[model samples]
Target: MPRKGMRSLCFSSPKTLAYAISRFPSPSRSTAASLTPRPSFNESMIQQTIAAAENMIVKWNPDTSSFAKVTSLFYEDRNEAMEFIKCVNGLQKAMHLMVTENSGSDNLVRSQNLMQIAMKRLQKEFYQILSTNRAHLDPESVSARSSRASTRSSTSDYEDDGTDDDIHAAGDCISEVEHVSVTAMENLRLIAEAMISSGYGKECIKIYTIIRKSIIDEGIYKLGVEKMSLHQINKMDWEVQEIKIKNWLDAVKIAVKTLFNGERILCDHVFAASESMRESCFAEISKDGANLLFGFPELIAKSKKSPEKMFRSLDMYTAISENWPEIEFIFSFESTSAVRSQALASLIKLTESVRTMLTDFETLVQKDSSKSPVAGGGIHHLTYYVMNYLTCLADYSNILADIITDSTPPSKLHLPESYFETTDSDDTPAPALTIHLAWLLLVLLCKLDGKAKHYKDVSLSYLFLANNLQHVISKVRTSNLQYILGDEWITKNEATVRQFAANYERLGWSHVYSSLPENPTAVIPPGKAKDLFKKFNSIFEETYRKQSGWVVPDSKLRDEIKISIERKLVPIYREFYDTHRVTLGAERNLGLVVRYAPEDVGNYLSDLFYGTGSSESTSLSSSTSSSNRRQSRSR
Candidate 1:
């Protein structure tokens, strides 16, 4: 017996069946007969499929379905939503078959209308699912879930033995958050694929971009990013700009690492069916926020170039540099190229600004025209400022290495080859930053050399050089500059400091050294001895009074200068005094002639570098009174 619905097609007579079969021509028939389309059993199947799809589609249509009006179809009843998606897919296929079979068929027009209604319903569901499950579909959670999914997929490929236990184990690895996110992403992808395949991609993209873009924009705002013009940034005081730069640094990390990155992941997952759709969706969602976030540095770079602003510029440079890989990957789409260009422009601008600030700082050091000398031969103000500045610069050497990689010192400033030398173990040429910093020091030293000449005394001039250079070297040795400017530089500069000290000792104390006899052991006449003692006393008092005001600010350098002077002068003076003391013993007013005892030589030398000139006269008067008392007691 025929099936219940097909009973009407059954023939009662055998002749009717034979005649119907005869009308269906063979494959060898004429072209006209061959082209004459014959209805097949598939026609009934397609009609049945369409009928089934209409029942499901009309039942859940957003306009007519009571269940869809009160509850989210996807969230509240996922099975029903799945059935609706399947029904829409079946309707689409049925419509395709109807069009192919007969272009003007009534069934084709009905399928088209049904398709529109079904799509409208699916669109509503898609929007509802996205809006209701926003927390579950957030970029961070979605990104994390995507990463775990990838990891689990790869792990299961290796670890699974096609056993139920292994499958369950893999399934158990997913957390509740992952399950929720996965369900949301899968549902979104299915609806997206159905809509896109049905030629409604623009609608899906519109909905996705609007919601995701707002989320990204809000995220950026909450992270404290703001769009400001170059004029606004330039007009801001450094203190205000500094706060903004800090906020930008923090915002950029969250924007790139979480906000933008998460958006990219979520977009890709939702539109996994079409590459073009995902790329376009991601670009539309994240481009505006990214461009504004990155454009800030370029504006700051265009601001007034000042030495103090260099570090903040470098900080902005570093934030972008560290996140460049993600920026490149996330904004790789052609539509989002503006974001990448903005980031690159900002980096280039920051680099140029940093280079300019360094040049300006070096120029400032060179043009320092403070004519008056630092009192008492102490460390100069310029030395303090430059060393402190360079010390801070050394902390960003890695970033600076990339910024000024090809930079060189100014052409007019000539530095010796030895200035660039590093330790033997380090064969790599000193980085550009190292050379740049070394040149700045050289400029400072040259400036200090010019300042040293302002002192009237030649010896004080040399003392000033020693004091300032020692300070520069001390700063280098203690900070990150030690690694940057190697030990060889420190050693060479230390020798120069010693040379300055020697020159100071020679020039400052030459008169006192010349007052002593060549050989202290020689037996000379009393008149000659009295002449020698008078000459020595006169020279010693004048030199001591002159040098007592000189200062060595560094404690180590101070003690060193004092010990050096004592080592050279004390032994010779003490030997001359002891050998010739008795020769002038009977001379009247002996205390006046031989005023200094051997022990008193060291005491006076100890007081030379303290920069206390007022105490020198009092000390000399007290010593003379005590010596006179001792001499009177002896008489």
Candidate 2:
């Protein structure tokens, strides 16, 4: 079937084909005699002419002469060019037959070269024409010029001297070019869609790639436009260019989506499991608990590549906005919005999968923490990765905020004004995007909070919470995120950390007091003293061995926790010492029996979080004194 605007060149009819063949001028007898050595070249010349005609399907406006050029052996005659509407169609059919019948002949090779030559010529001409007449295609330029013309006419008392005829001519040129370009774009779109439908995705990719490069070239021209001032350029012109860039980006986005869609760009080996597979995993792990130890490695390995794919999906759209300001202008709710939405949706799905994987991994860590400190290390690594993901989310959300706020009628991004209360009189109220991001951060923190509870050891659990919470708080405070979350939110999280610290101290020191004798009235019984010493040694050894390996990460919080534990256990040890020192005097070694002095007990507690406790012990005492002074002053 003939393509649109090509019915006149009806190559399907025998009479039309004969007419097309007749249009090809025969070689003169004199010319043929001169080519005696190349006597069989007449058929080759006809094939080449057909190929050239086929390639001229898309004509270039810039290449045509102002005066009519004479037809040559291959060039279209001016009258025939108008007469043959489907010139490319007829020529393509003729070339196809000639190549098919004489597939390996030198004539076919010459035809191919002719076809290629026509392609390059037309492509170059198309690019030049689009570049030269760009302003004509831009609605903004037309609008701005018309506005200026109107203003001039009004000032001249509506007198007409045809001075603005050039502007009118430019408008006419723009209208004509706009029609041609629109038709060209539609044809390309159809071809691209057809390629995709036929599973020629790579071909489609190449097509869009060329389109993007061409549009970028046009953008370079647009960018070079000189303005009297930064804001002096016509808004309509900018808006027009923005639409053009967005249209191209939108097409590229679709092409990319086609490449990614329905193909498992993700390593679905981790998340998308059949019920049988899941059951088998559970059964295998249950049969030999050791299998559970290496199970997370597979999950982790599978997930490791997923974030990168997800990032690329997001970067596909974001990179366009970064490179092209015109496309960026229409990002949020305009032509590029669908592609952005698709990219964001893919990102969200990937992140949610990551969250689920981490959640399950945390469960494994909790169950394994008692058996191996390796589990704790793994959790820390996972926590760091999760933090990196959250950082990406925060940065991308800021970009979304900028886009959503600037969208037509404004997108505000579902962030309510009531969400954030202004903490300082001078501080500006947080933008909707910031508040939206703060909420996302909160959701992640809450997820981490749930994961922290998986640790069997109370101190390890508290340490996990402290490290992650402190990280979140520090990030918010250091970045622009503080304005959204506010000082109160930070204070609240700090208080939660203090609560965890208190819990850590309470659990860790619980056994210390129980080791003291109930009655050291006169001389404590030898058996009771022996039991007391043994219990004290047992608890002290256990606490130090376990907690010394755990980490708080934050120096200040670690010190505070150490000091709190010191205050609880120190006085108890001193009282117990003063009460039972004489009773335990019969022991040959008092140092071994009492185990620790009051100061030594304080030192041990100071050393509980991390091994560098001696310096911290001194700091603890100073802090205690300072705190006491502050309390006294308040009183």
Runs with alpha carbons beyond 4 Å of true place in candidate 1: 1-44, 102-104, 151-171, 413-431, 525-538, 582-597, 607-618, 621-635
Tens-place lDDT digits, model 2, residues 1-635:
11221123332344443343233321222323322333233565665656555445324222353232222211334234322223333343344444334434444344334333333333333333334444442333323333333212111111223423533444464555443433333223223222222223233343333433343334433433211222322323544434433443444443223211101111011112122322232222121211211121222222333333333323433544443333222232232344344444433443444444433433433343233233331235445655565456555654455443432222234344543344556476556655544555544555555666677877667667777777777666675566555687789778877877676666766776666655434466776776776687777766665665566767777788777766666666677667777777878866666666666566556555543322222232212343353454356
Task: Identify the leading candidate in terms of TM-score.
Answer: 1
Clashing pairs in 2: 140-236, 140-237
Single out the weakest 10-residue window by summed lDDT for candidate 2: 262-271
How much lDDT does each candidate structure score? 0.77, 0.43
lDDT of 2 at 565: 67
Model 2 local distance difference test score? 0.43
TM-score of 1: 0.82
Per-candidate TM-score against the hidden true structure? 0.82, 0.39
By summed lDDT, which 10 consecutive residues of candidate 1 come out lowest?
A: 151-160
